[model samples]
Target: MGRKKTLTCRRWDCEEAPFLGGLCEAHHEEDRLKQLARRAAIDALSTSCIAGKLPEKPGLKDELLRVIRWWDKACLAVNAGRQDNVLLDETQYAPEWCIAFADAIIQEEMNFRQGLDDDATVAFLKKDTWTRFEHLEAGFMSNGVKRPGC
Candidate 1:
């Protein structure tokens, strides 16, 4: 009988057995949870954009920003290691380009809430922003970031 081969995780400076995709069990689970959270955050942000209402709940915007930043860090880590598909899965849960768009919407909404005068806020509210937001939301949802209620 042949002995099974022992392989270490591909992630740099680690010596854990490869569980899946050259990552150790810990790294694999961490990456999975990060992707899941990223996808959910993208969906929630898309939902908020579509609704055109800044959620009354505190820290929603902060959470979205944090997730986006985490994504950026993950990408950087992957790039630094020159490892393909290390931090992300095969699924296109959250695209790099869309994060910028999401951030822009978040920033706009935050600015509108914090900096805009009452009249400006009223004028902005009167515009057909909802239609534009809905279009953007539809695009994101269709691209695999699942929309809420669907």
Candidate 2:
């Protein structure tokens, strides 16, 4: 019988035998940690935006832009053959929804600061806005759109 060839890690400069997905155990762990950090950062930004804790203009705008850019990249990845339908839908429309929600919050913040609304009125407005946003998000999820940190 002929001897079988040994497979090595696919990563450059690594000669260790692959443990999973063509990566050595060390490389796999590194990739996992990196993904965790990326997800954590996304979650933090998303939570801030959803809670309306960001300043009305620049802060909200910045977060919206970041999320939009992320979705754009995700869509590009999908186009490059990622083949996740739910991710594709999310990358297509969730950013737009986020923008709309952020714009509404910014407008409400402006009205609140301009003395057009009392504290109680502003609170109710915020509550209503959040409820609507939640409903919209739930609708997307129900339709099989899985957008994390959205």
Candidate 3:
């Protein structure tokens, strides 16, 4: 009897040999490309949200920058992968995943603003931005003021 081969990539209908990361070369490349696509999507979404150009809404560049900073801070928690940081599972929340989550939040916020009055929109944006930053800060600091092992 011949030795059975290991499972290949998780991608649909792929048959190539699994490479270093449990993915075949072709599938790996495809995955990489998909990740890049997600990033581009997020970038476009962020830009549109910042510029308020997607739905003919006015942009809030300053608020967008604040949101970006908050996103960056959240990302930093997972920046080191499993090497030193244990707060995040690198595999669970990679850069693409994080950006996608943020993108979704921004999209939803914009969608909500469409139906709201000007004062309501301003209040919503302020509350939303502050909540996100607070959530990130709490999530990152819940264990204590000092970062784990830092």
Candidate 4:
């Protein structure tokens, strides 16, 4: 006979019983918000976000910088109605940021697995990940926009 699956939260590392949709209450809400954030990101990136040119030898940093501003804007718009945590992370990380950062890591891993090591992996590890954040924050703050996530 096949083993029945445990009715725990579907999210990683969470053992709490499911509240809805195979996730605990907190995780369910977070999942909902993450979905919204992702949708917003796709919408903005596809239709409205300013397009950036990729260099012939682009690195993870280049890709990140190209869309970081748009990601931040989309996060704010998507998470605005949530009265609780604006940032998926307690350290003020935007959910969109998390998604893109994870993508960068995954791409690097794939590249490494294929025996195609490059500057991209090193770029992903750089300390200047949030280089443009302060500028965006300043503009949003000066305009009295409600920025979420810390």
Candidate 3 lDDT (Cα, whole model)? 0.51
Q: Between which residue pairs do clashes occur in model 1?
A: none
| Candidate 1 wrong stretches, greater than 4 Å | 1-6, 49-54, 58-150
* Model 2 misplaced regions, further than 4 Å: 1-6, 49-150
CA-only RMSD, every prediction? 16.2, 16.0, 9.2, 14.8
Candidate number with the higher TM-score (2 or 3): 3
lDDT tens per residue, model 1, 121-148: 4234323333333434454332245446
Clashes of each: 0, 0, 0, 0
Q: Residue 20: error of model 1 in Å?
A: 1.1
Candidates' C-alpha lDDT = 0.50, 0.53, 0.51, 0.50
> Which candidate model has the greater TM-score, 3 or 4?
3
**Residue 82 of candidate 4: its Cα lDDT?**
39
lDDT, model 1, position 144: 47
List where candidate 4 sits over 4 angstroms from the true fold.
Answer: 1-6, 49-150
Query: Which candidate leads in TM-score?
Result: 1
Residue pairs with backbone atoms closer than 3 Å in model 3 (clashes): none
